[model samples]
Target: MRTAAYVLVRHELRLLASLAMWLARRTHGAGGGRVFGYARGQGAMMFGFAFVCLVETLTMSVLLRDYPTVHQMVFVLDVYTIVFVVGVHAACVVRPHVLDPDVLRIRRAVHVDLRLPVDRIAAVRRELRTTHEHADGELDIPVGAQTTVTVELAEPVAHFGFFGRRRDIHLVRFHADDADSLVQALGQALAGAVTQARSAPSPRPDLPA
Candidate 1:
């Protein structure tokens, strides 16, 4: 009996892990999977751009004798320089979002078993809106096959509705997300776990992302 019980426990853990892995992959979506590829493409384009800019600048410098228009050249160079800087900055921010070491990586990952325990639950921060006296936020709510929820928070307002304004309350805030199904499932599971932790006897530990 003891040997059989041990074997069963190992098998169950393996099954659960497999399910969790599946869910993680499913939730990541095709865009997430191609993050690395996107980053590589962007890097290549930037390199090519830099090479062309260098050649153009050098050629223009040599041709200064023929078209000695200093002001126009300065203006063109200034605009091009700004564009290059902005492009590089954008690439840096997007690189992490598509790479493995992304800062916004999931905090916890677990199997789809709703009965699983929850230790720490952090609110998803979709879009953060701030004001002098109060702060508001919005969550990406997928309405259906092609709908979405966009909420705006207002301070000192009784509720965070569409008409909420910046003034009136000392402070106010709201939040939302686009991952409706996963978030809803996670919420229900966490709520149940919280209830169980209070009444039932069990050890609920935090899961790794």
Candidate 2:
């Protein structure tokens, strides 16, 4: 119960922070690293859902006028529901996938944040996959029911779920607004990392007197 409450409170705070970031027209923790956003595909759908919620709110306000207590309670819930719907999208907008030189940060809203070391990435390509099986070592983060970029790791990386469940991920598939660009950038970053590793000079053996 304590863990559940903590998770709930943390989610609410994250939503509020996301809304603030959205209003401020800034992203979260995307400095120096290249940001790849996956929020574009769901914007229209989320707004449409919010519009439907608004309609329901107005309809309820008229229908429940006689019951003062009931109307007040319903009204509060309606407004909060609308905000929650919009806040989910805002979270996605603010927290995008970040690709740094050393780590590839993959995130989905407030739930999933998996950082894979660049050296562990074996291959990355632009592959649109709509169907995914429930696998033990694969993690799929799809936007609008489709994944655009696929990443295969040389070694498994540890991912902890929202409820503190650990999973070893050897394959990662996710969506990005500009899939090609993200794939290209990540490939280049991986290549650069490899080249730097190879080109690094080894320390000379100590010469004995």
Candidate 2, which ten residues in sequence have the lowest lDDT sum? 1-10
**Per-prediction count of colliding residue pairs?**
4, 0
Off by over 4 Å in 1: 1-38, 71-95, 98-209
Off by over 4 Å in 2: 203-209
Q: Which pairs of residues clash in candidate 2, taking residues 3 or more apart in a chain or in different chains?
A: none
Error of 2 at 16 (Å): 0.7
Q: How far is candidate 2 from the true structure (C-alpha RMSD, Å)?
A: 1.7
Q: Write the per-residue lDDT of candidate 1 for residues 1-209, one digit (tens) a residue.
A: 24657655654454444345444443222243212111232345556666777767776667674666884676488456645533442433232211121111221111111111134333322333332232333222111111121222222223222222222322212222233443454445455656767997667788998
For this target, which candidate reaches the highest TM-score against the unseen true structure? 2
Clashes of 2: 0
Clash count, candidate 1 = 4
Q: Would you list the C-alpha lDDT of every candidate in the order shown?
A: 0.36, 0.92
